[model samples]
Target: MSNWLLPESLADILPAEARRIEELRRGLLDLYRTYGFELVAPPLVEYIESLLSGTGADLNLRTCKLIDQVSGRTLGVRADMTPQVSRIDAHLLNREGVTRLCYCGTVLHARPAGLLSDRELLQIGAEIFGHSGVEADIEVIELALASVKRAGVQHARVDLNHPGVLRSIIDSDPALADFADRIHELLGTKDVPGLTELGTQISGVQTGSIQALIQLASLYGTTGVITKARSVLPALPALHAALDDLDVLIAALPGHEFSIDLADMGSGYGYHSGVVFSIYAHGWHDALVRGGRYDGVGRAFGRSRPATGFSLDLRKLSSGLPAAPVAKAIRAPWGTDAALVDALCKLRAAGEIVVQMLPGQLQWLDEFTVDRELVPDGGTWKVRAIA
Candidate 1:
């Protein structure tokens, strides 16, 4: 086997793609900063318990675990950064008022999320803690929309759902309790036949619950689906509250297209407590952004706080965008003379790309284009257009 061969679903990002990903990272982080979100970076690895706290089983399956050399305790490479950020907000910062935080880091997944996904992701996101209102949900959703827009994604749409709606219905019948996770999976794929099989196979499963699951499958479309859900779904207050939450978000964010999927569970993390949403654009096969209200994820850290936030993989985001333009550069010959050194410093300080050539070095730059040259003209260095 070739030594340079990488594992499936993992590949090294070369100069062009790496530069584009970096640019997107900087722009998104700067955007988060403008919203008053203070940046935070959690450790790349932590004790398994701390890393997996308050998240779903899916995250556990994705996390790569190892033995700690010092304590012999199990450690986990984080597959998601949200829980780690929650721990920080709850234990480290411990602020009493509404606290906004942002983070950018690399996450390792044990397996690829999808056919086209890389196991490694550059995850970047912003979170709002200490506020549980629909207002906080609105703010995060707006920021998520703004993020893809800042990345030049057009025709973006938001699909909203409330896991509580389905969760309440499942809770209404005790027989469905043990199969909750399986039911969520079936509903997520809108697998009506799979759900029907579940109804026939499970002992003591309620006929009404199975019927509601089937009905919920088709309850995805425009805002009108919310009204249809009320009529079709069981008359449970929690279910209605979930629908109301989606309604409020739609009202709060007018002029943006929205679709409601009552059956859609969530990001599989299972911590979302209120209105959850995904941002989708045309070019991407999957969602560009995912976020929502997760008010109690901090409980495991001994301090529960109302939190809402969203995150997206910068690598995935960069993959769908148009290719980044080659950076223009002023090619200069290597020299230690005071005048040449000063000229190079001044050009760099003035925000110019200056590539100094080494003796016998090849001029190969896929990431930059030498559009001009720095040369000695009449005992002074001058930048002239390259011919």
Candidate 2:
């Protein structure tokens, strides 16, 4: 007999942790509902073609692939929920103006190189389809901030950026377009020397703007930093416009701490047309939540809709946050007093944490300082405190 078990990167959530996750999930869903995003659960698996739409190669490689014998077609475990939700809006809902949807599910991503630490992660997210303007983007960011607060992630930082700023620069300089991959690598690694060397290669490149953007990447803290960024690259209108949009979002979220990172920080999603951002907590090294705008993804599915969203890596957040409180046990006296048994059963059924006491357990209860005691009476159970 072979002893096989779950993979290393995967995990099984048990009792208290699972309960905490469910409670957090419900809280987030309730928060999403307040913002008018109805809940929707997409399948865990889908046809490869459908799942592949709009997602980049990095994400595609992570998908767990399999061949469906019945249909004789390739299928994939969804690497992320965004593509599936997009499919729903395009094919099922078919709404044109605007559709706000929320989802909580598990996504499987196989990273052979193990670049990402986890293969199976629980994701909770919300998507707003059929909205293109900056207002929609702001709304998404605001909602994300609210959700994180509701989840009890203290001292979170919302780092905002836009792909358009980098895309515009690359488009203007054809030579730089070829070095896009290298530039992204440098940005990711914060290799300033390498970025400077690469910057020197492009003839007539705007070093001022590039340097400003690089400097902005390290900027953290309040709205006042935007003024400093504006001073550095005042001539670049796209950067200026992105800053303005950020100001609007900042004003909307006065309670949240925000900063701007312009070094082209992102997940390498090609469909992201504008305004990408990530959320980080005080303790976690990586972003707890990440998302942005993708206006062209729906068009690929024959539905020209603009959408924006953010998803939380629930497992990661759970690990970083404080531990959940455990329910205290309620001890009942021994002897199967029918009435007492029925009362304890009712308490258990009512979801109150309870524990049955053994014959000599009363002494143990005194030693342990148990929370409550149930005494069997003729037709009733008397509840008392043992403190």
Per-prediction TM-score: 0.97, 0.85
Tens digit per residue, CA lDDT, model 2, 55-93: 777778788899998998999998889988888898889
Strongest candidate by lDDT: 1
Worst 10 residues of 2 by lDDT: 361-370
Give each model's whole-structure lDDT: 0.92, 0.77
Candidate 2 segments whose C-alpha is farther than 4 A from its true place:
1-5, 112-116, 199-225, 234-236, 332-351, 355-370
TM accuracy, model 1 = 0.97
Cand. 2 Cα-lDDT: 0.77
Candidate 1 has an lDDT of 0.92
* Candidate 2 collision pairs: none
